[model samples]
Target: MRYKGVRFCVFTLTVFKFVNGYLMTKSPPRYVDDYDNSVHSKGKFLCLFLGICSLSYHQVSTARPGLDLVYQWKQLEFDYQSEYDRQADIDMEIFIPGQPAPIDTDVYYAANSKESKVFVTIPRFQSGIPLTLGTVTDKMYKGNPVIAPYPSWSWHRSPKTCATERIVSVYRVMGQPVHSYEIPSRLLEPRSILVTPVIDIRDKQCEDTFVYIADCQTYSIIVHNAREGTFWKASDKTMYPYPNYGTFNIDGDSFDLMDGVLGMAVEPYSPGKDRRLFYHAMSSPTENFVYTSDLRNQSIFMHDPESSPHLFHVQDAVKEVMDGILPKKSRKIYEAQYDTFVKWCCQRKLENVNEDVLLVFFAEKSKTLSSSTLWAHYSMLKTMLNVKRNIDVSKFYKLSAFLKRKSEGYKPKKAKVLSLDQIDKFLLEAPDKDFLMVKTYRGERRTQSAAEAIDKNGVMYYGLMSDMKIACWNTKGEYGDRLYSDIVASDSVTLQFASGVKVVKNLKGAQELWIMTSRFQKVATDTLSSSETNFRIVAGKVDDLLFGTSCKGKKHITGGTAGGGYGLISTPRG
Candidate 1:
């Protein structure tokens, strides 16, 4: 059974032998007598490859552009009872068994809404397929669905010698219109305008509906305001999967898993309340959420109803500009610095934040933390005070000079990162026999809360994100990929979040990956739902792990006799 159909107009040419129809207009019924069979065979071959099967209620116009597809509701499969019926037909010799087991070539659901029948097609590839098209009925035999001939069994009862009622083969079920579902003209018309591939579409239902589309090809999330028929790129893709990240070790098996945005859901909200849409990359072990209301506030790509809205409150606009000057990570650091000042003021019963109060705060912080750190506080508070309280701390010349004098001879060390090529060349060219790593590397300045485990090779292993990512790096930040991640590592649903990791060595000195997970995000967000055991530990051996985790390798290192440089995961002190 092949799901191939000729268009309504082409029907006259193929089925009716009308040559003067839509195709090759000639005298009507160009085939004379026995010539009809030749035309039928020719038409059948033409329909075989160029597929068409119309199940639509009406002829869909081909005037539009791009591809359009009907959503599949379900996959049709026969229950066990149906298989028994086919076997019974074989036993009765009413049908011959196919040499190889019948292969379900195609499937189609009954179009009638109330019908409980699903049809499966077993093509006559060999000989054993009993019927071309049969229905998997609602009736079950021995708690399994059963199959029967479509229309009636009589259709398949006739002998091949002179059979008219005998069901032979079916090309298609419904009438088709010419190229009704092919590439639409509208899509092809603006081929130059569309750049990104649409991979996912989700609806945000509100008074004004908006469709959130995820384009994985370009790593962009787009918002389409359905009411206005306009769309714009959004989110800046901060939550997208990072490069060289995403491979996890679960029980020592490494899996690359999936990539791109595959999961998306819009949270429900009350009529007057704002909703939140949650989504994340399929390969990612974390989730990112944005307010639905924020999506409605389109950028220049979509809406410009009031082209340029006046900045009514000058101070408010100034504050936003001031806030924009701060880096993402620095904002929280600045707020913490500003918060300490307010706390110090409260402790002294000082209400107003002025020069005198600031002088004392820095004076106190300078005594314990470094002069460099004091300068840090000064720089952050200068903008923090101006943006939050409209007070410019930079104007205090005496305070600024006092701090500047303390740092007159000091030089701050800058962080350095070796390029991948440089690191790779060094690893390959530098032999382990010539160099020896006798001491643990300690030049590290980066910090993360996830507890870490150091392997025998001096590579530190750690857990990253809720995806239960077991990552390892030989100090110089050489690796960030994970060992394993799945639903158990999801932050939102599972309380047992991947957090701390350790490489446990047994009495036999065999090493294993051990991880303890906790709901750190839940506590941080104040969304902790339970108070049971807050920890879950997952453990697997290094030797048994797959995907070349490098957990048990000698790492270009052999026994060395000469003294070597200090081996650390951090930069050299010099």
Candidate 2:
């Protein structure tokens, strides 16, 4: 869901088929207003729209949902009369004389359900697409519904150019222009220049007008005032991907395409929490629900309660606890990278914090640093700049590509663990009764070597039950306040025991432990399913109560002196 990675220009268009079935409704293709779908006496329906293909309407059975399918609609092949007419003037032969019809013409660009008709775009990216845009009719060709050109057949007489007189081979049609909104990279920082994150505006008939946006990358719900164009990164990280369990195994090809926060809906004609914004990531199996009032309320995003309500939390210890969405253990490394970038900018008297500055900064560092180190700085800076200076560097797609190019032939230095022979030798020769327990564990547990999955501060992170929470150990050798609240799920995504843990050491650098949580229990019981979360990569901070020392080896990386450090040193501008 990265901006640089989403290569498609045109997006999906949604269509709503009301309970009566005869009442088809279409709003602006890009941002449709939330429709109220009341359950009727006719029958309850379950509507499923493809990512960018056809729509299937299902009847939610009185027995159980999805138990019985009453009807399913598919798009049939077009006659190509419009394509033939459109290509006649351009001297292009429209159809081969009795050309074999496409084995499957199910591929469609987008769809909009208007009154009485469902409009669809059939991209002429290849042949067999009879028209650029058309309306689905009740008439069936073969067994599926057939499409007729919209407006009339005359409107689509041109090629893909979309010239003055023609609109054939079209993909961007049937969409009403909605106001563009840009998400401010960082909303928590003070100096950020705000931009609109508005994506969908509520119906004007409603008393309060709210703009809703789905930020796929950041996993945030952006809310804005439609009239004023003011926006905030609301419900940030409230929408996230749950690791899907199984693969799509057909007659034998297994495949999957991962996506995030693509679908959004605003529940209608209800008050309080029932009136909600419903959304889901395509990669996830569960739908996220937040009250429309929570999304509409500006108070939640506006409040900054670090330590006290009135005063700023200036104390480092408390500030470090609450003012972070990142690993508190790596706080110093993050700050160091930020200070270096800001110092470089100050030395050059540069004020504009944008892609150009970062590109040059990273480019210079790339000379001495390996690709991993270069990326390490990039990752650190991306978060730190947003946290400290309110700068969002992720929108710099060019920089991302540049760093990717720089990493073309580079590889990370693998951390060295004990060889099996060495392990065996130590097991046989080493003299300690404690080694018995180690050998027993190696024999019992799946013998995955756990590296120093702890931090320099003698603190470790582990998951707790009852409420999905993560508590850390204090220097006093007892569990302190939970540092992080892990994502709670009905499934044991976070509750499952960690399969493996590793610190993945960087030479003389601050490190955080990585916890690999998997439902091996599901695999054991043959209950694994793609419909639910089964695997997850979680970070767990580890601290020791036993020896008053964490598992992380004592290594502090200062990167030597200014001249010998990460990048070239620059003198401050006078």
lDDT assessment of candidate 1: 0.35
Query: What ranges in model 1 sit over 4 Å off?
Result: 1-207, 243-245, 248-254, 300-574
lDDT of 1 by residue, 317-357 (tens): 34333334445565557667766776677577675667777
In candidate 2, residue 73 scores what lDDT?
Answer: 28
lDDT for each residue of candidate 2 in 197-223, tens digit (9 for 90 to 100): 122224444224565555444455556
Which model scores highest in TM-score? 2
Model 2 residue 28 CA deviation (Å) reads 40
TM-score of 2: 0.32
Scored against the true structure, residue 192 in model 2 reaches a CA lDDT of 18
